[model samples]
Target: MHTRTRVVAFQPPVCRIVWAPRFAVKSASNKNSRRASQHEVKAATLTNLSSDRTERRSFVDCASEDTLHHPSQLPDDRQILQGCESVRAPLNVAVLLSGGVDSSFALHLLNRAGHNVQAFYLQIWFQEDFRNYWDSCPWEEDLSYCQQVCKDADVELHVVPLTDEYWDRVVAHSIAEIKAGRTPNPDILCNSRVKFGAFYEYLASHQDHNFDRIASGHYARIIRGDDPDEPVRLALAPDAVKDQTYFLAHLTQPQLSRVMFPLGSLNKAEVRALAKAAGLPNQARRDSQGICFLGKVKFSEFVEQHLGVWPGCIIEEETEEVLGYHQGFWFHTVGQRRGVPLNGGPWYVTQKDVHTNTVYVSRNYYSVDKERNLFTCESVNWITRPPDSASQVLCKVRHGPVLYKCDVSFTNGDQSAVAVRLECNDQGLASGQYAVFYQDEICLGSGVIQTTGVSHAEIGSFVDDQTKAVL
Candidate 1:
């Protein structure tokens, strides 16, 4: 049977899932109009999840349709205590600045320490309307945000427009990986390809080859080598709850040497505290979420804007019974249970067939289960080759949790479907996400997820058809 699922995406204000009230959505929509009304609504600020709608009704209510925003649980003070030993500051860094708190805060810390860090912001493909808002970031808003600090610290500020060619390199490749069912982490790719990519080339020539290193505000640590005898490779940041190393699993040694993470030692609270104390203006501003460059546009909004949406079916995993209709499949990720209307304890998305537009749901019973355990991946970019095909490894799927024991291997097991076999299976495994591999918390490498939960027979079937195309 064909696996691609179809979904029905509703228009904003009348969405099937009421993230906010209808009037609220309408008020937000009212602002998107071209005519400058006497009453301009507050700009909506949804990110990868949702944006804020001003002049629009309030979407962030206790009624609870907002699953995109991460829950609030600050890390403890201990988690932020990693700067104990005086560390070597980099000579220079090509930091990715979104003009938001994270990047902005990071630039301050690095520059204050006398490290050479040039900032760059990549503009993801956006509509003319939204694009104008973000333009103010570098030229008007974030430029001021960073300039004040950069001026105080006497550091130079640089901005690079994300050229059409740049998107082809970073964004397009990432979308392809996701469409093929691999969980592509654009943040990691943005750092590696954008900052460390052509941007690095531009900086070298611009600086007359004077700078020495690249730095940013990623909250991750390094473990450095394969064995204990080897040096520490970049591991999880000291702030476990906020450590973004899961996104950085793709960084190889060469990149690591040139990279610097000043916030590796600080937790979210600590960082905020420092921001406040440092007198950085955006410090108290709400933490910006979503795509780094896109500002507050929702992922669903952005994707629908591009690919557009269509009606689709929601089905039960076992019975394949039609449960309800949806606006679009792209709006959701696997393990999601909030929007789908099934009256029970809860149901997690077990599978999504893009072609059929079907979302398969399983009751939210097990934290981890066999159905969730079986996942496949491709676009495998390992920092170095794994020690063995099935070495015990610590793997994390997306930003859900810490590293768990898993057997690491690459197989034509699914053709175009590079595979990862987790030793202990978990429920709610979503396809089209990254499976970051590590050894004892140190990032080993990562791959894009292709398939999740295929039986031995299916694996064999894939091997037999390896020579053929996946679709």
Candidate 2:
């Protein structure tokens, strides 16, 4: 006899489930439109697992009879289950939803695998003082989508307000780094600090609710040894282009221990196909870009708003000539070509003098003679333990599929600092940028780039003091 698998709305505890009378769900006919009319939905009650008290949550049963796939047509559980090698059966999972197709699909997979899943939408967008940012972060629309997804899966959804935590942990650090003339990746901090950091802390305080593991839509894999004491190592996803292990490099062993990435084995195309086949509401939705907190707000605007403006000079590195002027030195980073106004030709930012408030540019930014591969990383965070000196490893200077084969050595017996020498040249190395380390497919950890070996002396002849002063 053959058993059949089907998409379902799992039944929860005896606690009541109600759809808030005021909560409006988008109608099926106007699904794609932002201003879609509200569909008539009955009220149901779902116990709020995020809070200490028994708070009543209105759950709208938005599961569409027409949209759901037939039992035989649903995606095979094996595709997702293959990644959960260490997962025990019937786990109480807390899933992080971003109102996107990926997270929604992960939730569906978990439900199909016989796990009890609860969804949480984190509110970390700018508010109050920064309310003017992008009219607003389009969070209401995102929340609506989250509610609909939860309703369809028959899972309880909770909205956790974490704006303060986000600003304190991620944004503050980013702003400070910018002011100090260093580049910082807030997304990395967001994953380590807010999504996984603050959210974990929030859940820990709620004694009444105890979740076995946290699941997310991140395209990264985790490999666990059979021994309970063995370290849980982070691995790369099959989707090279969409792999997010770089952002997750800062995560600790404890964080990795309680986390689950269900989309690890699938690529972007496969995810889209599975989502479409599953008839998910956001199956056709485009992937989000840039920093999450910024939303529709531009990065430049955010920088200007917080750091204000301080005019500075843009000097050519070879000639030390004043080619143009910029609003501020903090606004520009090393290797940045865009936004630099120079009439002659293409110029890349080579260096910056924070004291002089000057940005140095160069036309020969990628000159072959200039050795830009060597750099030192400070404040290194090892996922498991520090690697032995001269460990041959692969490192990512930034987020992308590209990984440079390199060697790392500890600095003067300092475990928190490592000197890295990449096998190839990278033009964009700058202070405060993270260099995530890896071995084969397992992610080792990450560190902030402190200094580089990039030198402009051999690139071209320098202008004399007389010529420089005249310009």
Candidate 3:
């Protein structure tokens, strides 16, 4: 790790200044120098220059005072100020603390780095009417844990209520997608619409504090582009298994520029170790699973509470055979094997007929007519620059640890919609689920799956033949 010392000092109610070591710099005569000098003082200042009562802070990096000795050798405050005259100040960073081990550890790391860190917990779950069904919602417990962690770190904690926004943007959209027979990842939408979107705006609009950037516990990285005009790109975390770039693929360039992920480089084990070392209260707490706002309640139960239940027929795709009956097709997804009440061994869901309220199943999960190597996607969002249409890209259709090599091409001259053909067959490419694109470890962009070349007729004949042969 490069050793750069940071010195922060607040000047009454006006502003606070931070001085740090600069990068390598070129000669004064070089007009197009790219390197910054180590002797140069890089200062970030939080100035209260706005006429309104609110304090506004901007991150400005300019040339400042002469370079001093190493931070470890600094003797007095006077010398520190003298060495950092023309530099910018430290940033006032607000971290979205979820009361989980990841966010808590991220907050600890930021504080240790000597940044002005404040913790904000978004209150996104409210079950006033459906309390009976959602009694297991963990917002209260999570909030308590967040408060404890913030108190231990001696940082101010803000509880920002965003329940309405979360429901309107993330939960509502998720329910609608599932009802339409499409599998939607609510966590992805939550990160884009709630965590980075609404939460960030709330902090920025606050009258008291002017936060420079917002940080989260997501396991992803932001690599700054070399060109000033180029947007920062989102990259995979060092821990491949825990990388969350897929969930954050829909975020725009501006949303990403103001966000930071402190846990990008550390894996789960390392995060646990760091949390233990920092004496966080919830170091041993188990990781949360399923939809975040749903908490411990079953997803089906939650959906039923909102969408209600509709009886549907579970038919065998091969023979049009009614294998079983389901309470609702909306609660099920393609490629799902569990919770399917079928008498003949294990069955996998292959297709859904929303209009007829029917679900098609197959005994062999991989052998289905709906299985295809090609699909189409719409609503594409590129993180930085769009990749060449002819270039081969690695694509992930779901949140699992698999990445498939695929060929991508825009459809009907539409830049935002794409057709992707994989090297091998993949079943259950659910509509509304994002197909994230990548080149090696760098996430290029993603698009919502629109359609796939899955023919139910082809699958029906195969299943019928197999059954006749077995009989």
Candidate 4:
């Protein structure tokens, strides 16, 4: 005799199940063996079905169709899905589209992942004269690309004119820093003040549109801290070579909590691959270089336009010889080599005396000193909680992958300001430049370089007698 049995299958909320019926063969002598074989076959069938469900789940959670076509080539769906549930949810999100490969890919990924995404391009450059000076000003082209991408993704694109805000907050601050003989990274201020600050405020205030979070294509990660008391932390991107964490060190806890970086785990190569796979038009487009707001104009040209050139003398540090002259001390920064009219060989601006209107130069650009290794920073903004006092931490004086070992000690009994002592020699430390602090891969916070310490001997040797007399 033969008995028929029905197998009912079910899956999670994401998928549906199917039912099938099969007949079981029975015999008197071989009944037990036959039954055992039937049971084994049934168990194997269920196992296979479970695997199919897993593959589908991987597709959904990973949010990349490339995984389905070439699973081995992409990262494990589990790894990509980690800490991404909030992003995968079908909530209203505002994406900052820069008409670049990264931002376009971000918009596509969020849309595919079932999120309600809207695209925004902040028009920060309003100067029409930029076209006259800069040959590569791609603002018009960039906006066109943004529009096409948004249209393809069926997302509405909004062009917000932030020119006034950008000039007021970021551009003004950078010009001020340059005039005061400090190196300022305007991108940092743009991210903190405009993108996450002003843009976010605009979106949140709208009664008609309720966005839960803002997303960008920046190559950095924001994750919940291990300690409950600590706020969310900003971390380095998985692709160290393309990490943008330094520019985001000034972001506050609230800003970080409300923002998402879709390209956090992806390298540049992976981003390009995904863009190509998704048919993004800007897949092969070149990445933007230099300052974001400056467009095609050179930094020196832009500075010179606003802050007119004031002619000054350049003195060699060692012999106090008049090596050459500079248009303005504000136009040159410490460790700058070019634009100094010198003939013998390469010369670097070692120091600037604003009082005497003199620039100091040295042949040994890589000169190491105790003063260069130590400096003080103010207006420190911590990403998470402040680290223990006098703790050993890593510091990045610029927006590169290089990290210098340093010890941080609070100054004037103020936690917001600190003195950093680098363990190794590093040149080009400028006032107004940010000293981004870190503990391993986590971005701790950042501060403005208020002043740098130089040995009296080093200063006196380089500065002219007239400048030293004033000092």
Candidate 5:
């Protein structure tokens, strides 16, 4: 450990796995959304006070309700720890445990580092009254895993239940966003709604529990700070080999302040070495892949299981011929290839007409690309404030890739910067994803792509926005 940074709390807001450190530190970080619905607008106005300099967004970990033999839920288990409203403490830290390699390692490292540490697991939900993962894991699920880790660390263990309401509000909204042709920011929303909203809100109700910092198993970083005197906003981890900033660009300064990334300074190999040296049983455990806490299931597949769908048609890009049919229009994306019925040619999914199950396809970008280089987004959350009137900054379409030089512009309302044109085009880019701007790897802020325009070649002085903008 590079003498890990001391924990800092933001008053009672210690919610969201994203606000933690696991998926957060990629240890060569490769990588790096959204509008204000009514729910988001409400969150913006809420704030809390702290008991100490280290008050985190305070939250509780409620146990679950289970069947006969497995009485996981303990009724009449209400306890209040106070001024929990904010999470900004310096002496204590919490690591979200999922019983996987990343989180396990994170828990062990933090415990050993001598910080006041505890382990927590948010209970996952079940379908048709069946929870598939409760006992299948090699170690216990996050809940018990946290318990064991806490016992060893001489700390408390917390278990937050993933209630039915969470699926309806968080999961369902995520599906709806993706289906609406928007690159749904589920992990981001999950943090805001469940972790921050329900968990922190409830945790704040307590009058005694006070911890300062929250950590997780994410693989991203915070580069610059909201306040120059403070730590920089999270950045790609130092290892750079397995960065996950792409999935975490939505972190705002409010969340960043109370967050810590202990593994941010280490690589997977180093973590394994530490785990092995510590004789942790799960030292040899393989790192879990895919979205943190979300699991290995494909995004589209999961959405389909919950969302009802209707079949639709596929159309040829140039000829407008009805090539074939598909299961549902929502299942495909602008640059996707699978799920679209084969038509004997090297066909790719080029467009989706949601009103009708009509997909458009073509052999090349010129024929089927409909993205606009210039697009708009709302409810802007920026970590770095651009110099006033300094309109241009290098921006990145996503993580993994470096930022590109561009001219930046915003809408008249300027709710968020509305448009950016790359110095040039990149092939096969699509709309509805995210376009995060960066200044030398430091993420300024990010936005959902509304449209992408391209400029076609060979027609001098006659370039359309679609042809000019790369998608």
Candidate 6:
């Protein structure tokens, strides 16, 4: 653990004058129309507030006392600052600090922007009853780093414990999906249901604090188009590999209206540099992986603890011969190559039977005949507006930089469900995974996968025939 320290820096009364960190900053040519501006206006007054006292350059003019809007108008969540319609004033932002480098750096940016920034650390770690399942909990250390960052930045910090909410919204949903033989993305649910959903509810109930926007270190951008009638659009980050729009696709318009992403323009390397330059305690800290609420516990251990183990046979799909046994069918998923107890060359888990409690494997998992390029998704959430069938789209079945060009059509003449056909065959098409849709850099939205287009009827009948022959 790194030692945490807080250094009180200078703050201006009317507007904070702080040095803009060395990174890409773009200006908005036409403030009224978002289409005219490719990037958000990020230029700020460059003044080093440290003891050395650097030179000041006024790139972004601060709002004078005469121009300052009334304090009462600052808390309106629906009030968006459009050209000539509203005055430019500092925002009251509630930043979600994860104690990671990206989020800590995002706090730095918000503080420099002269917003009334307050930090909140959500504690979703599994403790108490599930304490034994976790080898080590990192939320304590995360909170410590968050405290140090907020202290140095001279901002108030709040620790929001949402364990029960997390369980009800994300963890339980994940458990249910896994038990029913589907891959569930808890991070996606956490963003929509827990972080933005439950947190907003918590803020609303508490009248003492009123925030105009909820900021996070997410690598996504919000584009408010020229027409105020148009919904806010969630765009991809400059860093494609680190873009998190997929996880945030399910968030409602109201949630997105109040969302701010300061690290949207900064790439991973630029973020790291800014953190190191700001003297953050966790500048050198590695990024956290796996499920957000799991802490140090592996996903397999979580499933085993909740669902327990039911011993089942792992049979070869090509042959009805049983090759090995598995602890449970829920533990394995489609296209998983590792953790299977098999020795005859490499084997991939192709299917699982929940009722029979059987796992199916195949040596040639990528055969052309078995390729999956078609699927249907239900519960579709369109971020901006629903696109017509002729619209060009790209789809992501899972997280990462990989995206497949796809075609989409509304099922049964309505938008109740969507059928997606990928241009290329995918090997890991699993039910219950989210199919996030995008058009160019703009994230359209996402949906719950209802069908994987993989059938096991032939295999099931063949296994029964072999069993009868043996008997």
TM-scores across all candidates?
0.68, 0.79, 0.75, 0.77, 0.67, 0.77
Q: Please provide, for model 5 over 1-471, each residue's C-alpha lDDT reduced to its tens digit, 9 standing for 90 to 100.
A: 121211222222221111112112111111110110111101110111112222123121111101112112211101011111112233476666766656666666565455677666766444322225323333344455556556665667777676664787667776777667555656566665665456555456655545566677665554433454674564655333344555555666666666556555444444565566656655665554445433444556566676656777788887998777777777776666556577575576666776666878765543313333444444555665542334335555654323345655554343354556665443335555666665433556677766555332222223234333222
TM-score for model 5? 0.67
| Pairs that collide, model 4 | 182-431, 317-462
Per-residue lDDT of 260 in model 1: 61
Score each candidate by Cα lDDT: 0.54, 0.72, 0.67, 0.69, 0.50, 0.69
Residues 360-454, candidate 2, lDDT per residue (tens digit)?
Answer: 99888866556577787788989987654444467888876456667666654446776776765667889999999876567889999988763
The list of candidate 3 runs beyond 4 A from truth reads 1-89, 133-135, 226-229, 368-370, 389-391, 412-414, 454-471
Off by over 4 Å in 2: 1-76, 85-87, 128-131, 134-136, 388-391, 454-471
Candidate 6 lDDT by residue in tens digits, 1-471: 212121111221111111122222221122222111111212333332222322333233222212212222111112111111122237788999999988888888777666788899998877636656454767778888999988898999999989899999988988999999999998899999989999999999999879987889888778776875778888876444467888999998988988888777554655665577679889989888676556677778878889999999999999889998999999999888888889986798988889999999998886656647778788998876765445457788876545666766665333646777776566778899999987656788899998876333422232322222110
Show the lowest summed lDDT stretch of 10 residues, model 5. 33-42
Which 10-residue window of candidate 4 scores lowest in summed lDDT?
Answer: 35-44
Better lDDT candidate (5, 6): 6
- Residue 200, model 5, lDDT: 56
Tens-digit lDDT track of model 3 for 1-471: 222223332221111122211211111122232222222323333322113222323232222111211122212222112111112235678889888999888887777666788999998887736755355777778989999999899999998999999999998898889888888888889988999888877866877878766888887777665664677778776444466888999998989887777676544555676577678999988777666566667788888988898998999988998888998998888777888988876788888899999999988665433346667778998887666544446788865334666666665343676667765555657787889988645788889997776343432332323222110
Q: How well does candidate 6 match the true structure in TM-score terms?
A: 0.77
RMSD of each: 14.3, 16.8, 17.4, 18.9, 14.6, 15.7
For residue 4, give model 2's deviation from the true position in Å: 35
**Candidate 3 TM-score over all chains jointly:** 0.75
**Backbone-clash count (model 4):** 2
Which candidate has the top score in TM-score? Answer: 2
